[model samples]
Target chain A: MPGNRWALRYCGNMLSLTIKEVSLALREGKISPLELCRKCLKRIKKTQHLNAYITVTEELALKQAEEAESRLLQGVYQGILDGIPFAVKDNFCTENIRTTCASRMLKDFLPPYNATVVQKLLDQGAVLVGKTNMDEFAMGSGSTDGVFGPVRNPWSYAAPYREQSGGAEDDSEWVITGGSSGGSGAAVTSLTSFLALGSDTGGSTRNPGALCGAVALKPTYGLLSRHGLIPLVNSMDVPGIVTRSTSDAAIVLEVLQGRDLKDSTTVQSPTSHAGFSEDFDVRNLCVGIPKEYHAPGLSQETLAQWSRLADLLEGAGARVREVSLPHTQHSIVCYHVLCCAEVASNMARFDGLEYGHRSTEDSSTDAMYAASRHEGFNAVVRGRILSGNFFLLQQNYERYFLKAQQVRRLIAEDFEHAFSAGVDVLLTPTTLSDAASYSHFIQADNRTRSTQEDVFTQPANLAGLPAVSVPTALSSRGLPIGLQLIGPAFQDGMLLSVAHWIEQRVGFPSISNYEVPNK
Target chain B: MLGIHQIYGRRRVQLNIILPLLCRYYYASRTDNMLSTNVKTLRKTRNTPSRPVTVARLYSSNKHNSKVPKVPTWEPLGEDRIPSLPQVSSDLVDKLERLALVDFRTKEGLVCLERAIRFADHLNMVDTTGVEPMDSVLEHGQLFLRGDTVTEGDCAEKLLPLSNTTVEEYFVAPPGNIPLPRREERASMLKHSEF
Candidate 1:
């Protein structure tokens, strides 16, 4: 009601509004939360061909929107996000809502309790739009491995080609929405939802956000609570935020960050809120460019854009220097060892005899367990489990698992030393290249491809550092290419502030031209 | 003479029951052709009305009415698509299955196992020594264990409905061949074994 006296002026439709704009509209009585929900639902229905959502919580969304409208009318609105509609990746449990982590094992598993983050958002009057799809068990770099089917990148949908010769080929390839949080990225990119939550473990959130042209933040480990967030790699897992801009990501991060009794990994005291102003001074900021990150697989377009961004920052009085993170070369291998080892331990609980899908085999308990898991999990998940079990074995434990852990510490220390030496933030490419075609992506093995995809992103997770993917340029094929900015642990505010400055200067083009009706 | 006749009749009936069971047990353990034939013969004679025993199935399937989805087909990739690595032997796969409680015997499972081994080969290239392994991401915090208290009180009644095999107040599992000692069986065998 504070902004209600302002003149209510909105564009033709609500789909173009950001979360901040939507909240302002709600407060100014330009549109009711119910109206906003209905518009979003319509957009979602229109974009069904994208396959971004596994379950659309239509009824629940309408109910919450009604509550928000009533609160607004009573002059007791919650905050800026009071009536915002958003989606979360299906991995997070919602009370009585089906949370299938894109695997058949949890296809029908309904959690009896809500994840702490979901409860926090709902308490702030954020309307739950639906649950988006992802890579099964968050194990792959592409979202094609989901049981519900793959999510197509909204930016990569090319129109049917007309042939001069008489024979026509159908769209031979569909562009992949990078995973395992691809659906959430696609949802926000296509303007089907105002915002969405993606869980980042080794770039699950940033990869998709980069490909889909959205802002994704993987906050520093322990800065945000991880309770009830179905773990992929518990030590590196953090709930990430996906939005159209850096400010929205920061706002949502504020709403979600806290110290929780249920999660022991959180900071002892609540960190300060992520507040940033347009006038936040970024002059003379020291930006590090890790020389090792300029690897062999990086594309020419991405490299050019990365260089251009550095020049822009330098022109704005920031010192862009090539800083050496010596351990960067081994981070990916170290990440794989730790990720698999942790996955082996975390996935043991889904033996099908407990909360997930059970096998029909009654032969023996052991046989039943094997059969259930074999039938429930996909190839990607099964591969990780096998590799994890091997690394954690007593015979190989010292050689593989223990050594990887030591290397992991070195990687974290590298970031610590770099930050301690007055490097304000480290700038790198979010991914090796732009989004690949489904045909090209599946050509390689899932593990190999995933490792390649996470090369630039996983180090942030391994070091327990905060990182964000900001879309900076377009590739020749017209796909979005994102650059990453990572800061020291618990320095998320400074990291995001510099990212915000870059975002305003770049003013990158979004994916609006590809919203064609499904043929 | 009359008592002997009655005893012989009882012995004949007992033999009829024990003979089929013995054949089944032998058939299960042995790969001999003659033993398998004997099992078949016993099974054929099992339907005779003289020894009436009914085996009822609590679960039945309506397979005819249910429609099973077809498996998706995809174009196969050439050998070059898959990077060659140290091949995991079948024995190693079996060990992995035992450790993971997941099968890798099927086609898809085998493919997954091969891919995993290939990924492991990549991790093997790194050299690490004297570095402490970080089991957790916590920099300076120690594990905080909660006080021993009843956080989750009795929720058996709420949880019973979650499974399909709930009977009365207990969740039931399919009875298997493994002979687990039950509470009633323990009470009955108290005299034979030390408590």
Candidate 2:
């Protein structure tokens, strides 16, 4: 069986090329975008059991690819990303395509327009491969909470992509793809998409990417326009990039980050692009090791990888020192309060009226609203709304919501202090441990599991700092471990350069380069 | 929500039901209003039991919108310092249903609210003395506002189709309380007499 698994790895290399490799091939006229799009579509169909995608835009993808192919052949390409096949997390609205947010509420929701990011990619001639699956309303730590079923990690031990033994039940005892951006993470790592857009409200993108062995990036807040990316936590939400390598992530981020009139929260002034030159150096870097990130429940394997990277950085002529962010202990709790409050506020918009699930069997307007929400949303999403509403309550507003905001200020200030004190970037573990199995992941409640899993990632979202999860190495269990590098606000380029340096030194294994059997 | 029926006992539930009907009857007879009369008449002559009727909920939207929860007294743990749990109640659950519009009186919803409050109680341990609340991380830079000039308009034809229920020119919705119908009932009624 192991031999067969290895033999199957040789079935294709066309699906496994990175965005940079794919771009070179396209430019050299060795591979047409249409051919690549067809292969991507075929790969998606082959991996349908993984449940990584909610809607595969085969027809539209082919149409876009053909147009790109024509432009490429005619030597009138729009840009470097012209004809690159990429996927968008289902949360981003795609004009005339279903954007479910992986919730039953939007099971049939087709948006009237595309998200700003989606439109930008399309305008640049990037082919829209499909919309990836995610937690319902991007709310869970494990993608299992998504209505479409869990996005199984390609590297999970329950082999051949964690096919359920029960067949019908999605609750198989397999390793989880950390979420709420689990599907986007799965898509990139599994070679289903070259690049995928994942929204990082908390640790949604990094959590999943770390578990799935993909580089996940959350740019500084407002670096990317949030226009059509459905709001999870309006302020914390940023469109994250998922790719096999740091450079691929940097290339994608360069295209996606910009201001627009559609998203008011976009950074008003033009910010620096996250592109680093080929001669990037680590000598000038001052890396901070946040002592607060040695959080409880952090696995020894994860700590060893983090420390190993710190040693490597120090040995490579970069200064590494311990920095303390005292408010870190209180961040997870602060995140829950602020995140839930925003969730309740954003969810109030979905009442079975404006472009979502509508329950026709109900009589009263209130009944319809209640029935639609109850049926459309999963327990995780509904629970957040209820609790969020509790915080936003007139009486509790002062204690929960207001206090949370004040703590949020302190949290952001901690990052400000660390960055101002001459820390070019902070190094930490992306997740507490390697991916946990579905059986163990579900042992705790969604709220507790999310809190524990998202502890490291959430603080970055709260501080509105740019952070990236670079896949460091394989754990003893053969699952991937990722290390996070968080930079000061708008210093995304410097952060990527450091990440690229680490990525080169670590040389984490991507599926594309995995050794096949009988070579 | 079952309205007063959920809160009141069986004996009091009957009186609670009659009181709303009486108020509707009073509003129905007021000659200045006709559309309100139709809604009242629909409830008045219906043969079915008023089990699913929500006459009281129209005003319930604002009933407890301003009610605040009493903050629990915080106590330090034995050296480890785990924040003590916040006290959760059925009244809080009731308000959640009213405000969020989800049925939180269920076992799952109820458990979630209680657990979330317990998690949120962690904030009480921190000394957030003189910190001003940061509403948005974008507070350092102002939001880039566009001119007030019309950027998008005249797309009612495109917008109305997104909803499942739409009239000739507009989306069909229960405007505030009474669900507005397709075409003005009186205008159509005056145009053609029903059998």
Candidate 3:
């Protein structure tokens, strides 16, 4: 009778567990570490069809969970994440493990060290479930450009798969996971991991977060280290966290945020606000609405959602006003020039020499360099490299690179002016529209012509500010629409505080709303 | 304008003074002649001090003779006349023996010798401070070593004997024997040299 009672208690405890809940359960001796790991692995296997992970180290995870169980029994539990399972974008280096960055070039490369963020998470006793796939070198707006394959939208897992519906047969019907952090978002949504780390150059983290119905925070530039991240652009790339809730993202940020000696760009600052998980007051907050963001392409549904958000905030006693960012028009051009120039410089080191896949021929040095690059890199990456090199050439350097720098300065100044007008936060859509199908994304004029869709997101990257993408509404077709809140530099906590308040008020549905179809 | 008697008396007194002036002029001329004779005698005896007296007599007898031997101010020494010195001293030999003993005891002397060898090696590698002995070979011009040769001057036909050996040899290769051939010929040679 006692055994039966104990078994029932254990089963009841194991159901519906979060990180904190699991921690409490472990502390109370209601469940063993082996039991927790077993349940998580079972859930991961059951949802494998969601395609959330590129590699799952079941053996390693089980071994680590056993060690964690021993420590817990000895009353030496590490912290809140003592036995939690998490995943990271493949771009982040994991020691002695393959980190492909979803690109052919690094398809076989194994780093000798871990990314600082990954190292921190592991040190806090977080068990790594696997490495998630991402856009090729984290460059695309959709996760479809990966060398392995496109990551499907978890929201579309239960949607009816249409046959013979479109222009290109190959790209006919799958919904985009909204890259370049799409895999991280999907992994968390599918419950493959409690938290995932992703890099955000220009809305990569937030766009995927919005689309996958997860909470992702793009921390202030240099707030976290970028040492082991395969950089897209050194100046603007920030390693961010994507998780199921704002509190989870905050906990991951607290664990990973610090100054690292290997990454010189991360500035050493005083300790951030203690206990960011505490509730925040937003009654006197001022939210700014840039008139320019309401351009001609804003979908009626998105605009209506924005109006509803303003009304909700006003009802909650927050003041909202309209503002102008005069230099918003030049953001796309400036972003392309600067980002490509940086890409050209950063990619120059990957000439098939030290690591990565090498070419088969032992030809002349130039031939060797050229052949390896041509074989290793994909078409989109190659295009960016070429464009970056073109802008950085001697003749076009001043006209393209310098003009881009000037435009970047103007965009930053516009934000500065708006902030100086007593505005506490700025709100806008994460993207101009919701998730597009793969064919629509590929056939879109902007994707074919140039990288012009980054017009709204690139300015924040250029300015090196903090922004968070929180779901405000869902499309009629059941796609998540996110509203981003941009804050002043180094005010990430404040921005997150306001975002948390708005998240509570708006009450966006979690992944529980989406059903996982049985296989 | 004076009277004839005063003029005649003044003339007789002037004649007396004129007679003494003529006597003084003759004596001065005789003194100058004697001085010239002595100068000639001194010059003739200047070269051959051992035969100064005999050479003076010969010069007095035949002043126009061109067969007299002349003496030079400086003379060149032959190579065989240079002195030689011993290469090493007895004290140094004794010291070397003692150092050899120390070498047997602790190898300190061997280390010193090795350091000396290394120093010599460094010296050999360093550039030469003295004028290069092959400078004449490298430069295609009149080469001079320690100022031992001479060359042309401004005025023609005036052979200004150089004070030192300032002029060096100027080697001019025959036309066909030039080290660097013409460009076309060299190219042809290179083309034919290779298989």
Question: Which of the numbered candidates is closest to the native, going by highest TM-score?
Answer: 2
Worst 10 residues of 1 chain A by lDDT: A159-168
Minimum summed lDDT over a 10-residue window in model 2 chain A is located at A159-168
**How many clashing pairs per prediction, in order?**
0, 2, 9
Clashing pairs in 3: B143-B168, B147-B165, B147-B166, B148-B165, B148-B166, B149-B165, B149-B166, B149-B167, B150-B167
Off by over 4 Å in 2: A1-12, A157-173, A268-275, A515-519, B1-85, B174-195
Show model 1 residue runs off by greater than 4 Å: A1-9, A158-170, A268-275, A513-519, B1-87, B107-115, B121-125, B142-152, B175-195
Q: Write the per-residue lDDT of candidate 3 for residues A1-519, one digit (tens) a residue.
A: 323322424665352455667667776667776667777688778877556677787888898888877777777878778888888999999886789988777887777778998999888887888888777898887887788887777666532222112112233355677888888987877666778898898778887887777788898777799989988998789997887666666777778887776776775434664345447766778888876676545665565456556655665677788788876755665666677678777877675555675555333443344445656776667656655655665755655566666666667878989999989889877776767776677774223312434545767888888888887655644466787889887777778788777776555655453345323
lDDT of 1 by residue, A5-95 (tens): 2236466567767788788888878877888889889889988888999999999999999999888877678877898899999999998
Docking class for candidate 3: incorrect
Off by over 4 Å in 3: A1-18, A159-172, A270-277, A445-453, A517-519, B1-195
iRMSD for every model: 25.6, 23.1, 50.6
Ranking by TM-score: 2, 1, 3
Q: Give the CAPRI class of candidate 2.
A: incorrect
lDDT (Cα atoms) of all candidates against the true structure: 0.74, 0.76, 0.62
Number of the predicted model whose lDDT against the real structure is largest: 2
Pairs in steric clash, model 1: none
Ranking, DockQ, top scorer first: 2, 1, 3
